[model samples]
Target: MSDPYGPPPSDPQEPQGTPYGNQPYGQQPSGQQPYGTQPYNQQPYGQQPPGQPPYQQPYGGSGPSNPDERTWGGAAHWSALIGAFVALAFLGPLLVMLVKGNQSAYVRAQAVESLNFQLSILIYGIVSFVLAFVLIGFLLLPIVGLIWLVFTIIGSVKASNGELYRYPLTIRMVS
Candidate 1:
């Protein structure tokens, strides 16, 4: 192609903006730092910018950022409630228990309790369904449901407080 702006510059010291690009490069205004760099030695936003030593260090030193710390332990315990209402039975607690059990003692215990209770409720529900043919199932079903509801709420509250709670009727099938 013919040179639209004549031949390339002869000087080696010329500032070619965006070396490989066709855009013309220009000098930055005085007192301004280049993109990707901060004024002087300052770090960019979201970074732990360097600062002069403080006269007094803050109380309660912090540990390295821990992913585990961010996970709420109570949710695992409360998953049974979520599962009961949302999954119509056992999937919620099962999922939370299996996924988060190993990450925290709070999660492990709560999830285990919730899982065990859900399993027990599953069995009770089946038994109640069968008893329904005999008329006793109709009565037992509400009782079973009430027990499940009350205990699940208690478990959720205890778990939220970081307190250990065990469902009285839970069978502990999975330990």
Candidate 2:
């Protein structure tokens, strides 16, 4: 009796061949080049391969490279609206700047611009409130709110388009 663990017996009707079928070890099939040789159309490292288009670096490696970055940039400006609802006009931009600023320069610049503008608005609002004792603060407060809305909208639109926006009258305190 044959051993259970032993190899199966070869069929007598089959023709004898190498262990790897008809081809021997280290040999390629017919019409194919041997191993260790580069293909005829292969290009060197860091080069565009034959028949392939060259790769384009996104935003020249400086600006926002993808849609997410652009979204974040726009968010940095739009976030101030949320903060404004809570009477903390700088909080939204400040949070966005702190979280995403280091990842992209575009977002950082937008956030900084929004944060500075919000801060300036905060100061204006405070002065307006104090001056309300003289009755003029009431007028100044509405004007400050109008200015904040207009500039924040402009900044958001520009940033959404992947453009860096600088708010007019920003104090640039954070830089």
What TM-score, to 2 decimals, does candidate 1 have? 0.56
TM-score (all chains, Cα) for each model:
0.56, 0.63
Candidate 2: worst-modelled 10 consecutive residues by lDDT: 54-63
lDDT of 1 at 160: 68
Per-residue lDDT value at 61 in model 1:
21
lDDT, candidate 1, 1-175, per-residue tens: 7687897755676654444333346655444465777776776675564584533322122321233522344566566677666646566666776786555555656676777888899899999999999999999999998998888888767666656667797787886
Best by lDDT: 2
**Candidate with the greatest TM-score versus the true structure:** 2
Give every collision pair in model 2: none
Score candidate 2 by TM-score against the native: 0.63
lDDT of 1: 0.66
